[model samples]
Target: MNTSDEVRTFTVAPDDDGVRLDRWFKRHLPQIGFGTVSKWARTGQIRVDGKRAKPDDRLVAGQQLRVPPGGDAPHKKPREKPALSEAEISQAKDMVITETESAIVLNKPPGLATQGGTGTKTHVDGLLDAFAPGEDEPRPRLVHRLDKDTSGVLLIARTPGSAAHFSKRFSGRSAKKVYWALVVGVPEVHEGVIEAPLAKQPGSGGEKMHVDHEGGQPAKTKYRVVEKAGQKAAWLELEPMTGRTHQLRVHCAAMGNPIVGDGKYGGKDAFLTGSISRKMHLHARRLIIGSPEGGKLDVTAELPEHFAASMEQLGFDIGLSNAEPIRDDPPPKSREEKKQAARLHAKQYRKSRKGERRGRRDATTAKPKPKPKPKAKR
Candidate 1:
């Protein structure tokens, strides 16, 4: 074994298909033991692309894998990014729910982008491309996408046919989509539908969708307020009837209650600042889609830390059993914040005024004609 040599990690490209992790290392580095590879998978040594590669982790024709910096690295410098901690990369790898000959399912975490975009080098799609099995092997391709800030079930198709089939279902609205959002206030109407339109803002080559009435695509969403936030915020369960880019975001915004931590659409309480990011409050909670082979497929994703953090900071009671929010007044208010407070305060004032008006009208209608009886008697 070359003890002092450094090894360069290779993403699972087509040329490296059908190779076992242990076998790949043996070929690449003479006599590294199978036990050593296994230990590395357990520890933080060998990784796939930027993740830890298990000994038995089947090498797809193309997947990204890393050979550790120690032990027989290339003579010249290897052009790879700083290798990921075996733990962080492996954590994502472990979230794959199902994998078949034709596709793979992953519950993507919040904060991880689905594919490479501007200023994003490491993403799920690029890693899949690098780790794919062969030139002839079908690459793992995205059928749909979740927001970089939203965590949820994501589907990948291994074949072109599979990709097309899944795409059709999403386009036709045959996919069952469910989402959970932490928003700023309990709505007056608990269960109602929000129908609105979405327009794409194409200025910075980013996927930012806005609410537009005229030149926008049509969209609709139905929501039931799951839990109220003591007039401050609410936890909502949403079912989108149509699939438009950022449909939920725009609809919520149009309803005058943008989600917490959603800075783009004018969310107040949970806007992104230095510590909080824009993606904290929304999650793709669950998905049910038809499998390429046969029956129904369902997957769920756990709430990522950012969403949880918002919950912690806001103290919104999200309908959990026996969960208690701090029993104190809300934080000190600013002048603008006070104005918004007045708007909510007007709700109670208006309700009392309306009651008083109704009472006066009822009294007027109930007056008797005693004067006519007295005149008849006289």
Candidate 2:
């Protein structure tokens, strides 16, 4: 209903600091589509502090955003979400393990995706409307994701600001997540690190991942064997040092000990015989991350029914293993950071060499001592 031809200017609020320019539009101007925003940005119609801005450009607090008018013009309505049924509402509430003012930790069950995709209908994101506080308030946001078939502790941010906060923790590698998995065989080394690069498989239409050493993104995982079922199976605790798509699954498969029931990577060898369920035996056991409200949020999810049954059948004692989070290895520096560090090191080296050269020059230029006049020919 904004009919004024004049442009509108908004001051970026503190809560929205560091958000992407397009995201700001989505948050503040829901009526405007991403295509429209991108077009406006391309045409230099949108300005941040009197400078043309890109959609992905990060906005700082107190910056003036100049938006051209006509964004509120009538357009095709967005598809409305179908109303949730009673059963769907119950299912969403049932998954909540812990709820704070800023986050909701869910013990997500296997087979439910974190977000929707082609052929994925009953995903966790669709149910998030159940958690919306009110008509005007923003719905909860997914800060992180789990595989459709890999379930465990999934965190949901209650607000956009908190979503950004949690996302930073995850991207910075400060968040600790522990996964429990049952692999086909005990690893030769009881505990070790798996460092492998991964890439999308060539012919799978990006539905699968493979270990691509020569040309792939760096990925690392630290694994410790909790207990073994006489070499037939082993319950392993896995910590991913890098967040790569299907990193853990690919790494474990590459280690020659594919996780039990993961047929995609391991194929026939991934399965176990005699009473083990075919369901993937990987569960996100625990998550520890900084909460928006100051302290840390540490929560553990109980093993899924199939996983628990398999462990019991294998006679593995859950109490025998420690669940403490391993200290995360520092994330690799970005290209810019690496360049900055190299420049600093070179500068220091040059400065030190300069000091040494100056000392040598001073010593060489100083007049030679008389050598105490040869001690008066003593």
Candidate 3:
């Protein structure tokens, strides 16, 4: 791997697809530092497929990277403690509902964060090291995220190639996700769609979202009422068509009854009285996605204790149904369709710029108001 004295080329594998050039170096050629990569990129010494590439440029599968010599970055000593603690290892092992050669399905518990963030000391990503079969094994990668307070089936790709494949399925909307939530009240319609657009609330530090029909990105959620607890609450099966942040919470709230215990979106109305717990009742009930190995990977997760207890208290059925989940998902766009869309967007952008220039020219070319009126008044 020491090509420090000679030029070398590397082919990007499926594992490295969509990875930034700088990140690729960090993973494949750790001896290269950020400064060295930046210098090489700036000087046209680092090339991707015969073209100079930037550090932030995303690499694709089968692309060749031409690397120049001089990767002499200093090596740092290893940390004293092992990556995973004993408790974290146990927690990670206990959370696994099932495992395969390419994937592991976890029934994540509520309040356990999927990844670390500010003020977060422990999380699923940190605990995943326990699943490593050997020191040389690639660390498991999270295919998707579950909110810190939402528990359910979470998929971990055991290999980088699997990670790349699963990621494509999710981004292409071929992956099917079914969620169950207990809301504060029953929706009027038994089944319906929420077509509200959502955007981040200004000044919330990205913590809140609101409907911004005019300028927001499109978001849609399809929901059906599985059961209702009189007028107090309802059990809903929800499927989000787009993977917008907090789309489910916002959509449910917009429907006049938010998921129970979702205080952020529903405010005080999201709560319910009696023996029911105040924990969020949303769960990722099932996930059906095409595996990298060429078959379907379908897994179901059981509800958490609080969610199950609430169901029992509210007289909702806790058993699984044989009914197939509804999937009206749109098909992935064809390559030609995507190219046409890009062309259309470019044409519209040019038209908009032309209009702006015309408006400016008209304003500057306009005749000045007659000055004689002021003198006559005086």
How many residue pairs in model 2 have overlapping backbones? 0
Cα RMSD of all models vs. native, in order, equals 17.4, 15.6, 14.1
| Tens digit of per-residue lDDT, candidate 2, span 280-335 | 98999999999877899999998889999999999999997656765445346568
lDDT of each: 0.69, 0.88, 0.86
Per-residue lDDT of candidate 3, residues 1-378 (tens digit):
444678888999866778899988877676678998999999999999999999999999899999997766546532233567678889999898888878999999999999999999889988887998465667788989999999999999987667777898999998888899999987766576899999999999989999999889999888877788998999998988899999999999999989999999999899998888999999999999997656899999888999999999999876644224664653465686578668879888999899899999999999988776554654
Residue runs of model 1 more than 4 Å from their true location after superposition: 1-92, 134-136, 201-207, 267-269, 272-279, 309-378
Q: Compared to the true structure, candidate 1 yields what TM-score?
A: 0.58
**Native-to-model Cα distance after best TM-score fit, residue 197 in candidate 2, in Å:** 0.7
Q: What is the clash count for each candidate, in the order shown?
A: 29, 0, 0
TM per candidate comes to: 0.58, 0.72, 0.71
Clashing pairs in 2: none
Best by TM-score: 2
lDDT (Cα, tens digit) per residue for candidate 1, span 1-378: 334546565656443466677766764554455776777788977777677767877677557676655544335342234345566556647768777655687878877888887799767776564435354454568989987877777888876556766787888878887788887767665666887788887693556887778988888888866666477778787778888877888788778778877777754554634554466588777777786677877766677777777666666554452211112233455576577668778987998799899999999999676664454654
Candidate 1 residue-wise lDDT at 211: 70
